[model samples]
Target chain A: AQTVTQSQPEMSVQEAETVTLSCTYDTSESDYYLFWYKQPPSRQMILVIRQEAYKQQNATENRFSVNFQKAAKSFSLKISDSQLGDAAMYFCAYRSAFRGGSEKLVFGKGTKLTVNP
Target chain B: EAGVAQSPRYKIIEKRQSVAFWCNPISGHATLYWYQQILGQGPKLLIQFQNNGVVDDSQLPKDRFSAERLKGVDSTLKIQPAKLEDSAVYLCASSLRAPSNTGELFFGEGSRLTVL
Candidate 1:
Protein backbone atom coordinates (compact mmCIF):
# COMPACT_ATOMS: atom_id res chain seq x y z
CA ALA A 1 0.00 0.00 0.00
CA GLN A 2 1.20 3.53 -0.79
CA THR A 3 1.03 6.19 1.89
CA VAL A 4 1.75 9.90 1.73
CA THR A 5 2.95 11.95 4.66
CA GLN A 6 2.86 15.69 5.22
CA SER A 7 5.08 16.46 8.19
CA GLN A 8 4.01 20.02 8.70
CA PRO A 9 0.48 20.28 10.05
CA GLU A 10 0.46 24.07 9.86
CA MET A 11 2.48 26.66 7.98
CA SER A 12 2.52 30.45 7.85
CA VAL A 13 3.76 32.74 5.11
CA GLN A 14 3.77 36.48 4.65
CA GLU A 15 2.23 38.07 1.64
CA ALA A 16 4.62 38.36 -1.27
CA GLU A 17 6.91 35.79 0.32
CA THR A 18 7.45 32.15 -0.46
CA VAL A 19 6.72 29.01 1.52
CA THR A 20 7.56 25.35 1.00
CA LEU A 21 5.37 22.52 2.25
CA SER A 22 7.11 19.20 2.75
CA CYS A 23 5.69 15.79 1.79
CA THR A 24 7.03 12.26 1.58
CA TYR A 25 5.60 8.97 0.44
CA ASP A 26 6.24 5.24 0.54
CA THR A 27 5.51 3.24 -2.57
CA SER A 28 6.82 0.11 -4.23
CA GLU A 29 6.00 1.19 -7.74
CA SER A 30 8.92 2.48 -9.79
CA ASP A 31 6.96 5.01 -11.79
CA TYR A 32 4.13 7.07 -10.35
CA TYR A 33 2.75 10.59 -10.17
CA LEU A 34 2.74 13.16 -7.41
CA PHE A 35 0.19 15.91 -6.99
CA TRP A 36 -0.54 18.88 -4.78
CA TYR A 37 -4.13 19.87 -4.16
CA LYS A 38 -5.48 22.98 -2.49
CA GLN A 39 -8.76 23.18 -0.55
CA PRO A 40 -9.98 26.57 0.50
CA PRO A 41 -12.39 27.26 3.33
CA SER A 42 -15.14 26.73 0.79
CA ARG A 43 -14.13 23.03 0.78
CA GLN A 44 -13.35 22.88 -2.91
CA MET A 45 -10.35 20.75 -3.69
CA ILE A 46 -8.40 21.99 -6.70
CA LEU A 47 -5.30 20.63 -8.29
CA VAL A 48 -2.29 22.85 -7.85
CA ILE A 49 0.53 21.03 -9.61
CA ARG A 50 1.63 17.54 -10.63
CA GLN A 51 4.96 15.84 -11.21
CA GLU A 52 5.77 12.63 -12.98
CA ALA A 53 8.27 10.44 -11.17
CA TYR A 54 10.06 9.61 -14.40
CA LYS A 55 10.69 13.26 -15.21
CA GLN A 56 13.87 14.67 -13.76
CA GLN A 57 12.69 18.22 -14.14
CA ASN A 58 10.35 19.64 -11.54
CA ALA A 59 6.82 20.74 -12.40
CA THR A 60 5.92 24.42 -12.27
CA GLU A 61 2.54 26.08 -12.65
CA ASN A 62 2.48 29.80 -12.23
CA ARG A 63 3.37 30.45 -8.56
CA PHE A 64 3.06 26.77 -7.64
CA SER A 65 5.84 24.27 -8.23
CA VAL A 66 6.98 20.90 -6.94
CA ASN A 67 10.38 19.59 -5.97
CA PHE A 68 10.09 15.89 -6.71
CA GLN A 69 13.01 13.75 -5.56
CA LYS A 70 12.26 10.21 -6.59
CA ALA A 71 15.30 8.73 -4.86
CA ALA A 72 14.47 10.36 -1.58
CA LYS A 73 10.76 9.65 -1.94
CA SER A 74 10.13 13.33 -1.32
CA PHE A 75 7.75 15.66 -3.14
CA SER A 76 7.49 19.17 -1.79
CA LEU A 77 5.27 22.02 -2.96
CA LYS A 78 6.55 25.59 -3.19
CA ILE A 79 4.25 28.57 -3.21
CA SER A 80 5.79 31.79 -4.46
CA ASP A 81 4.45 35.31 -4.17
CA SER A 82 2.02 34.09 -1.58
CA GLN A 83 -1.27 35.93 -1.50
CA LEU A 84 -4.23 35.97 0.87
CA GLY A 85 -6.01 33.62 -1.50
CA ASP A 86 -3.36 31.00 -0.84
CA ALA A 87 -4.59 30.52 2.68
CA ALA A 88 -5.96 27.01 2.60
CA MET A 89 -5.30 23.37 3.40
CA TYR A 90 -2.86 21.75 1.00
CA PHE A 91 -2.78 18.01 0.42
CA CYS A 92 -0.13 15.89 -1.24
CA ALA A 93 -1.39 12.91 -3.23
CA TYR A 94 0.16 9.90 -4.95
CA ARG A 95 -1.11 8.01 -7.95
CA SER A 96 0.15 5.09 -9.95
CA ALA A 97 1.08 5.63 -13.58
CA PHE A 98 0.18 2.14 -14.65
CA ARG A 99 -2.52 2.01 -17.27
CA GLY A 100 -5.70 0.05 -16.31
CA GLY A 101 -6.87 -1.28 -12.94
CA SER A 102 -7.22 1.01 -9.95
CA GLU A 103 -5.75 4.52 -10.09
CA LYS A 104 -7.21 6.17 -7.07
CA LEU A 105 -5.13 8.86 -5.41
CA VAL A 106 -3.59 8.32 -1.99
CA PHE A 107 -3.48 11.63 -0.10
CA GLY A 108 -1.55 12.83 2.92
CA LYS A 109 -3.16 14.29 6.00
CA GLY A 110 -2.79 17.94 4.89
CA THR A 111 -0.94 21.17 5.65
CA LYS A 112 -2.95 24.18 6.65
CA LEU A 113 -1.30 27.28 5.19
CA THR A 114 -1.92 30.76 6.50
CA VAL A 115 -0.93 33.88 4.63
CA ASN A 116 -0.54 37.01 6.71
CA PRO A 117 -0.81 40.41 5.14
CA GLU B 1 -16.86 23.28 -19.27
CA ALA B 2 -18.96 22.59 -16.22
CA GLY B 3 -17.16 20.96 -13.30
CA VAL B 4 -18.47 18.09 -11.18
CA ALA B 5 -21.74 18.88 -9.41
CA GLN B 6 -22.89 17.64 -5.99
CA SER B 7 -26.19 18.06 -4.24
CA PRO B 8 -27.35 18.66 -0.66
CA ARG B 9 -24.41 20.85 0.28
CA TYR B 10 -25.16 20.16 3.93
CA LYS B 11 -26.89 17.24 5.66
CA ILE B 12 -27.51 16.63 9.36
CA ILE B 13 -28.86 13.38 10.67
CA GLU B 14 -28.94 11.52 13.95
CA LYS B 15 -26.88 8.45 14.54
CA ARG B 16 -28.54 5.28 13.21
CA GLN B 17 -30.33 7.38 10.58
CA SER B 18 -29.84 7.10 6.84
CA VAL B 19 -28.27 9.66 4.50
CA ALA B 20 -27.50 9.86 0.82
CA PHE B 21 -25.40 12.13 -1.43
CA TRP B 22 -25.74 12.77 -5.15
CA CYS B 23 -23.06 13.59 -7.70
CA ASN B 24 -22.97 14.51 -11.37
CA PRO B 25 -19.62 14.15 -13.03
CA ILE B 26 -18.33 16.23 -15.89
CA SER B 27 -19.66 15.31 -19.31
CA GLY B 28 -17.63 12.74 -21.26
CA HIS B 29 -15.63 11.84 -18.19
CA ALA B 30 -14.96 8.11 -18.07
CA THR B 31 -14.27 7.76 -14.38
CA LEU B 32 -16.10 8.84 -11.26
CA TYR B 33 -15.06 8.65 -7.59
CA TRP B 34 -16.55 9.07 -4.15
CA TYR B 35 -14.30 10.18 -1.31
CA GLN B 36 -14.80 10.60 2.40
CA GLN B 37 -13.05 13.51 4.06
CA ILE B 38 -13.05 13.34 7.81
CA LEU B 39 -12.36 16.53 9.68
CA GLY B 40 -8.63 17.36 9.76
CA GLN B 41 -7.86 14.65 7.20
CA GLY B 42 -7.49 14.50 3.48
CA PRO B 43 -10.15 12.96 1.28
CA LYS B 44 -10.03 9.16 1.18
CA LEU B 45 -11.53 7.30 -1.74
CA LEU B 46 -14.44 5.08 -0.84
CA ILE B 47 -15.49 3.82 -4.25
CA GLN B 48 -14.63 4.27 -7.90
CA PHE B 49 -16.58 3.58 -11.06
CA GLN B 50 -15.32 3.36 -14.61
CA ASN B 51 -18.30 4.07 -16.81
CA ASN B 52 -20.92 2.34 -14.66
CA GLY B 53 -18.61 -0.51 -13.71
CA VAL B 54 -17.08 -0.87 -10.30
CA VAL B 55 -13.34 -0.44 -10.45
CA ASP B 56 -12.21 -0.19 -6.85
CA ASP B 57 -14.07 -0.20 -3.57
CA SER B 58 -11.59 -1.76 -1.17
CA GLN B 59 -11.85 0.97 1.44
CA LEU B 60 -15.61 1.17 1.51
CA PRO B 61 -17.44 -0.12 4.58
CA LYS B 62 -19.72 -2.42 2.65
CA ASP B 63 -21.89 -3.23 5.61
CA ARG B 64 -22.97 0.36 6.09
CA PHE B 65 -21.99 2.15 2.93
CA SER B 66 -23.35 1.68 -0.59
CA ALA B 67 -22.83 3.52 -3.87
CA GLU B 68 -24.02 3.19 -7.44
CA ARG B 69 -23.55 4.79 -10.85
CA LEU B 70 -26.52 3.52 -12.85
CA LYS B 71 -25.88 5.15 -16.22
CA GLY B 72 -22.25 6.08 -15.71
CA VAL B 73 -23.12 9.77 -15.65
CA ASP B 74 -24.52 10.33 -12.18
CA SER B 75 -23.71 8.59 -8.86
CA THR B 76 -25.14 8.26 -5.43
CA LEU B 77 -23.60 7.27 -2.08
CA LYS B 78 -25.75 6.06 0.73
CA ILE B 79 -24.97 5.33 4.36
CA GLN B 80 -27.43 3.34 6.42
CA PRO B 81 -27.61 3.48 10.19
CA ALA B 82 -24.96 6.14 10.14
CA LYS B 83 -22.49 6.33 12.93
CA LEU B 84 -21.41 9.48 14.67
CA GLU B 85 -17.90 8.89 13.38
CA ASP B 86 -19.29 9.03 9.86
CA SER B 87 -19.76 12.76 10.23
CA ALA B 88 -17.59 14.25 7.53
CA VAL B 89 -17.64 15.68 4.00
CA TYR B 90 -18.40 13.56 0.95
CA LEU B 91 -16.55 14.67 -2.15
CA CYS B 92 -17.37 13.62 -5.72
CA ALA B 93 -14.78 13.77 -8.46
CA SER B 94 -14.45 12.87 -12.14
CA SER B 95 -11.51 12.23 -14.41
CA LEU B 96 -10.80 11.62 -18.06
CA ARG B 97 -8.32 8.85 -18.75
CA ALA B 98 -8.09 9.27 -22.48
CA PRO B 99 -4.81 8.73 -24.28
CA SER B 100 -4.28 12.46 -24.62
CA ASN B 101 -5.25 13.35 -21.08
CA THR B 102 -3.13 13.18 -17.93
CA GLY B 103 -5.86 11.68 -15.74
CA GLU B 104 -6.44 14.94 -13.95
CA LEU B 105 -9.33 14.86 -11.48
CA PHE B 106 -11.87 17.65 -11.09
CA PHE B 107 -13.60 17.81 -7.73
CA GLY B 108 -16.92 19.26 -6.64
CA GLU B 109 -17.84 21.32 -3.59
CA GLY B 110 -18.27 18.47 -1.09
CA SER B 111 -21.49 17.67 0.72
CA ARG B 112 -20.94 18.07 4.43
CA LEU B 113 -22.61 15.41 6.62
CA THR B 114 -23.17 15.76 10.33
CA VAL B 115 -24.28 12.70 12.28
CA LEU B 116 -25.35 13.73 15.74
Candidate 2:
Protein backbone atom coordinates (compact mmCIF):
# COMPACT_ATOMS: atom_id res chain seq x y z
CA ALA A 1 0.00 0.00 0.00
CA GLN A 2 1.15 3.53 -0.77
CA THR A 3 1.40 5.99 2.12
CA VAL A 4 1.99 9.73 2.34
CA THR A 5 3.57 11.57 5.28
CA GLN A 6 3.60 15.24 6.20
CA SER A 7 6.05 15.73 9.03
CA GLN A 8 5.08 19.25 10.06
CA PRO A 9 1.81 19.42 11.91
CA GLU A 10 1.82 23.22 12.00
CA MET A 11 3.61 26.01 10.14
CA SER A 12 3.58 29.80 10.21
CA VAL A 13 4.51 32.35 7.54
CA GLN A 14 4.44 36.11 7.46
CA GLU A 15 2.51 37.89 4.81
CA ALA A 16 4.43 38.34 1.54
CA GLU A 17 6.95 35.75 2.71
CA THR A 18 7.47 32.18 1.64
CA VAL A 19 6.86 28.88 3.42
CA THR A 20 7.56 25.31 2.48
CA LEU A 21 5.61 22.27 3.66
CA SER A 22 7.46 18.97 3.50
CA CYS A 23 6.02 15.65 2.31
CA THR A 24 7.33 12.14 1.68
CA TYR A 25 5.75 8.97 0.34
CA ASP A 26 6.32 5.24 0.07
CA THR A 27 5.23 3.52 -3.09
CA SER A 28 6.50 0.79 -5.38
CA GLU A 29 4.88 2.03 -8.55
CA SER A 30 7.21 3.94 -10.84
CA ASP A 31 4.53 6.11 -12.39
CA TYR A 32 2.46 8.22 -10.03
CA TYR A 33 1.20 11.71 -9.37
CA LEU A 34 1.54 14.02 -6.37
CA PHE A 35 -0.75 16.83 -5.35
CA TRP A 36 -1.17 19.50 -2.70
CA TYR A 37 -4.66 20.35 -1.51
CA LYS A 38 -5.75 23.25 0.67
CA GLN A 39 -8.66 23.01 3.09
CA PRO A 40 -9.92 26.33 4.40
CA PRO A 41 -11.98 26.87 7.56
CA SER A 42 -15.09 26.41 5.43
CA ARG A 43 -14.02 22.80 4.93
CA GLN A 44 -13.65 23.09 1.21
CA MET A 45 -10.73 21.12 -0.16
CA ILE A 46 -9.10 22.97 -3.05
CA LEU A 47 -6.29 21.90 -5.30
CA VAL A 48 -3.13 23.98 -5.00
CA ILE A 49 -0.62 22.31 -7.34
CA ARG A 50 0.29 18.97 -8.85
CA GLN A 51 3.43 17.18 -10.07
CA GLU A 52 3.99 14.15 -12.22
CA ALA A 53 6.75 11.79 -11.20
CA TYR A 54 8.08 11.41 -14.74
CA LYS A 55 8.60 15.13 -15.13
CA GLN A 56 11.95 16.43 -13.99
CA GLN A 57 10.99 20.08 -13.98
CA ASN A 58 9.10 21.25 -10.90
CA ALA A 59 5.52 22.35 -11.36
CA THR A 60 4.72 26.00 -10.77
CA GLU A 61 1.30 27.64 -10.57
CA ASN A 62 1.40 31.33 -9.81
CA ARG A 63 2.61 31.61 -6.19
CA PHE A 64 2.30 27.88 -5.61
CA SER A 65 5.07 25.51 -6.74
CA VAL A 66 6.18 22.02 -5.91
CA ASN A 67 9.62 20.52 -5.40
CA PHE A 68 9.19 16.93 -6.47
CA GLN A 69 12.25 14.77 -5.88
CA LYS A 70 11.21 11.48 -7.36
CA ALA A 71 14.46 9.83 -6.38
CA ALA A 72 14.14 10.76 -2.73
CA LYS A 73 10.38 10.11 -2.63
CA SER A 74 9.96 13.70 -1.48
CA PHE A 75 7.40 16.22 -2.67
CA SER A 76 7.16 19.64 -1.05
CA LEU A 77 4.95 22.68 -1.59
CA LYS A 78 6.31 26.23 -1.47
CA ILE A 79 3.94 29.13 -1.07
CA SER A 80 5.43 32.43 -2.19
CA ASP A 81 4.11 35.89 -1.51
CA SER A 82 1.87 34.36 1.08
CA GLN A 83 -1.29 36.25 1.87
CA LEU A 84 -3.67 36.11 4.79
CA GLY A 85 -6.03 34.13 2.61
CA ASP A 86 -3.44 31.38 2.49
CA ALA A 87 -4.13 30.39 6.08
CA ALA A 88 -5.47 26.85 5.88
CA MET A 89 -4.69 23.18 6.33
CA TYR A 90 -2.52 21.82 3.52
CA PHE A 91 -2.55 18.15 2.64
CA CYS A 92 -0.19 16.15 0.44
CA ALA A 93 -1.82 13.47 -1.70
CA TYR A 94 -0.77 10.67 -4.06
CA ARG A 95 -2.37 8.61 -6.82
CA SER A 96 -1.22 5.96 -9.22
CA ALA A 97 -0.73 6.80 -12.89
CA PHE A 98 -1.14 3.34 -14.27
CA ARG A 99 -4.10 2.83 -16.54
CA GLY A 100 -6.90 0.64 -15.13
CA GLY A 101 -5.58 1.22 -11.62
CA SER A 102 -7.72 2.80 -8.95
CA GLU A 103 -8.02 6.55 -9.35
CA LYS A 104 -8.78 7.29 -5.71
CA LEU A 105 -6.41 9.69 -3.94
CA VAL A 106 -4.44 8.83 -0.83
CA PHE A 107 -3.70 11.77 1.43
CA GLY A 108 -1.31 12.58 4.27
CA LYS A 109 -2.34 13.81 7.70
CA GLY A 110 -2.00 17.54 6.84
CA THR A 111 -0.05 20.68 7.80
CA LYS A 112 -1.84 23.61 9.35
CA LEU A 113 -0.44 26.81 7.80
CA THR A 114 -0.92 30.16 9.47
CA VAL A 115 -0.32 33.34 7.51
CA ASN A 116 0.31 36.19 9.91
CA PRO A 117 -0.12 39.76 8.76
CA GLU B 1 -20.78 26.73 -13.44
CA ALA B 2 -22.00 25.62 -10.08
CA GLY B 3 -19.68 23.27 -8.23
CA VAL B 4 -20.60 20.20 -6.21
CA ALA B 5 -23.51 20.62 -3.82
CA GLN B 6 -23.99 18.96 -0.43
CA SER B 7 -26.93 19.14 1.92
CA PRO B 8 -27.16 19.57 5.69
CA ARG B 9 -23.91 21.47 6.24
CA TYR B 10 -23.96 20.24 9.81
CA LYS B 11 -25.52 17.20 11.52
CA ILE B 12 -25.60 16.09 15.12
CA ILE B 13 -26.80 12.78 16.51
CA GLU B 14 -26.28 10.60 19.51
CA LYS B 15 -24.48 7.31 19.24
CA ARG B 16 -26.64 4.52 17.75
CA GLN B 17 -28.68 7.07 15.82
CA SER B 18 -28.89 7.16 12.02
CA VAL B 19 -27.82 9.96 9.70
CA ALA B 20 -27.62 10.54 5.97
CA PHE B 21 -25.95 13.05 3.69
CA TRP B 22 -26.85 14.10 0.16
CA CYS B 23 -24.55 15.20 -2.67
CA ASN B 24 -25.08 16.56 -6.15
CA PRO B 25 -22.04 16.46 -8.41
CA ILE B 26 -21.09 18.95 -11.08
CA SER B 27 -22.97 18.71 -14.33
CA GLY B 28 -21.41 16.38 -16.90
CA HIS B 29 -19.02 14.86 -14.37
CA ALA B 30 -18.87 11.09 -14.64
CA THR B 31 -17.04 10.33 -11.44
CA LEU B 32 -18.20 10.94 -7.87
CA TYR B 33 -16.49 10.23 -4.61
CA TRP B 34 -17.24 10.23 -0.89
CA TYR B 35 -14.52 10.99 1.63
CA GLN B 36 -14.31 11.07 5.41
CA GLN B 37 -12.16 13.75 7.05
CA ILE B 38 -11.43 13.35 10.72
CA LEU B 39 -10.22 16.30 12.72
CA GLY B 40 -6.50 16.94 12.21
CA GLN B 41 -6.36 14.24 9.55
CA GLY B 42 -6.38 14.19 5.79
CA PRO B 43 -9.42 13.28 3.74
CA LYS B 44 -9.79 9.53 3.30
CA LEU B 45 -11.75 8.07 0.42
CA LEU B 46 -14.67 5.92 1.53
CA ILE B 47 -16.34 5.09 -1.77
CA GLN B 48 -16.09 5.90 -5.46
CA PHE B 49 -18.52 5.58 -8.31
CA GLN B 50 -18.21 5.92 -12.05
CA ASN B 51 -21.62 6.96 -13.14
CA ASN B 52 -23.95 4.69 -11.15
CA GLY B 53 -21.53 1.80 -11.01
CA VAL B 54 -19.35 1.22 -8.00
CA VAL B 55 -15.67 1.41 -8.84
CA ASP B 56 -13.96 1.12 -5.50
CA ASP B 57 -15.45 0.87 -2.02
CA SER B 58 -12.84 -1.19 -0.22
CA GLN B 59 -12.16 1.47 2.36
CA LEU B 60 -15.78 1.95 3.32
CA PRO B 61 -16.91 0.33 6.54
CA LYS B 62 -19.71 -1.81 5.16
CA ASP B 63 -20.91 -2.79 8.59
CA ARG B 64 -22.40 0.63 9.34
CA PHE B 65 -21.90 2.77 6.25
CA SER B 66 -23.70 2.72 2.93
CA ALA B 67 -23.67 4.93 -0.16
CA GLU B 68 -25.32 5.05 -3.55
CA ARG B 69 -25.38 7.23 -6.64
CA LEU B 70 -28.72 7.41 -8.37
CA LYS B 71 -28.97 7.67 -12.17
CA GLY B 72 -25.30 8.67 -12.17
CA VAL B 73 -25.92 12.08 -10.70
CA ASP B 74 -26.94 12.62 -7.11
CA SER B 75 -25.53 10.56 -4.26
CA THR B 76 -26.34 9.72 -0.68
CA LEU B 77 -24.26 8.38 2.19
CA LYS B 78 -25.85 6.90 5.24
CA ILE B 79 -24.58 5.70 8.59
CA GLN B 80 -26.71 3.39 10.71
CA PRO B 81 -26.21 3.22 14.44
CA ALA B 82 -23.48 5.80 14.22
CA LYS B 83 -20.47 5.60 16.48
CA LEU B 84 -18.57 8.36 18.23
CA GLU B 85 -15.56 7.80 15.98
CA ASP B 86 -17.77 8.38 12.97
CA SER B 87 -18.03 12.03 13.81
CA ALA B 88 -16.26 13.88 11.02
CA VAL B 89 -16.79 15.86 7.86
CA TYR B 90 -18.22 14.05 4.85
CA LEU B 91 -16.96 15.49 1.61
CA CYS B 92 -18.39 14.83 -1.82
CA ALA B 93 -16.34 15.38 -4.93
CA SER B 94 -16.63 14.98 -8.67
CA SER B 95 -14.29 14.77 -11.64
CA LEU B 96 -14.57 14.87 -15.41
CA ARG B 97 -11.17 13.22 -15.92
CA ALA B 98 -10.52 15.02 -19.16
CA PRO B 99 -7.16 14.10 -20.61
CA SER B 100 -6.11 17.71 -21.06
CA ASN B 101 -7.39 18.90 -17.71
CA THR B 102 -5.37 19.05 -14.55
CA GLY B 103 -5.83 16.14 -12.16
CA GLU B 104 -8.05 18.08 -9.82
CA LEU B 105 -11.32 17.03 -8.22
CA PHE B 106 -14.10 19.52 -7.53
CA PHE B 107 -15.22 19.37 -3.92
CA GLY B 108 -18.26 20.42 -1.94
CA GLU B 109 -18.34 22.41 1.30
CA GLY B 110 -18.73 19.14 3.21
CA SER B 111 -21.24 18.07 5.85
CA ARG B 112 -19.94 18.18 9.40
CA LEU B 113 -21.25 15.44 11.69
CA THR B 114 -21.23 15.26 15.44
CA VAL B 115 -21.97 11.94 17.16
CA LEU B 116 -22.34 11.97 20.89
Best by DockQ: 1
Which regions of candidate 1 are displaced past 4 Å? B98-100
- List model 2 lDDT by residue over B46-73, tens digit each: 9999889999999999999999998999
TM-score chain B for all models.
Answer: 0.97, 0.96
Candidate 2: regions farther than 4 A off: B98-101
- Tens-digit lDDT string for candidate 1 (B1-116): 89899999999999999999999999999899999999999899999999999999999999999999998899999999899999999999999864545857899999999999
Each model's total of backbone clashes? 0, 0
Give TM-scores for every candidate, taking all chains together and pairing residue i with residue i.
Answer: 0.98, 0.97
Global lDDT scores for all candidate models = 0.93, 0.93
Each candidate: RMSD: 0.9, 1.2
For candidate 1, write residues A1-117 as lDDT tens digits: 999999999999999999999999999999888999999997789999988888999999999988888899999999999999999999999998887747789999999999999
Which ten-residue region of model 1 chain B has the weakest summed lDDT? B96-105
Considering summed lDDT, which 10 consecutive residues are worst modelled in model 2 chain B? B96-105
